[model samples]
Target: MQTFHLDAISQDRQTLAEPYHEFLRTRDMSAGVYHMEPGSHDPQGAHQEDVLFYVIRGAATLRVGDDELEVGAGSIVHVPARVAPRFVAVAEAIDVLVVFAPAESAPTIEVKYTA
Candidate 1:
C-alpha cells in the first residue's frame, strides 16, 4: 500500500526549493503538490500530458488558453495537453494537488506567457 501526507510532501518540496513536488509516479499517472505564495508568478508552461488540479486551499484566477476563471479551495480543474495554463492574481497562498495523466516525465511544450 502507498500512502502520503500532504504536509510532508509540502515540506520536502520546500526543502528542494521547488514550487511543485511529485510524490507519486507510475507509468500511467503522477501526482504532486504545487504551492504558490500570494502574488507569485506561475512558472509552468504547456505540457504534453493532460493535467488535473485539485485546489486544496487559497484562491486565484486561473488562465487556460484565452479564458480566465476564478478558482479556490475545493475546486477541480482540468487542462488538456499542449494548452497554456497559468494562475494569476493570486489572492492567497495556494496549495494545489496536481495529477498528470501518463506521468509527466516526457518532453513538454514551452510557451512564453504574454500576460
Candidate 2:
C-alpha cells in the first residue's frame, strides 16, 4: 500500500555509482528510477535477485551475458539472478525504471553502475 510519482522523484538527481531515485523497498521487491547520460556505461556485474529494466526514455544497447540488443523507450529487459549484464553504447541519455524481486540487500560486486 504505497505510491510514488515519477515526475517528483526524477527532479532531483544524485551522484553515486549510478544516479537514481529509489522509491520502494520491501521484503519481496524493490524499485527505483535510474538516469544515465549519453556515453555513460554501467559497470559489468551480476545480482543475486532477478531484475527488470523498463526503459522510459532514450536508447541504448544492453548486453546480458552473451546476448545483446538495442533497447529504447517502451522496451522491457529482464536479467536473471547471478547473470551479469551491462549497458553500453548509449545513443541517447536514458531513463529506466528498475525493479528487483526478493529485494537485493546490496550489490554482489564492489561497484554497480545502475539502479
The candidate scoring highest on TM-score is 1
Over 1-115, each residue of candidate 2 has an lDDT whose tens digit, in order, gives 7778778778754543447677889999998888888877686588788989999999999988777999999999989988877787789988999898988766555334454
Per model, state how many residue pairs clash: 0, 0
Clashing pairs in 1: none
lDDT of each: 0.90, 0.81
lDDT of 1 by residue, 1-115 (tens): 6999988998999999989889999999999999899978997789989999999999999998889999999999999988878997788999999999979965668866566
Clashing pairs in 2: none
Give me candidate 1's TM-score against the actual structure. 0.90
Error of 2 at 58 (Å): 0.7
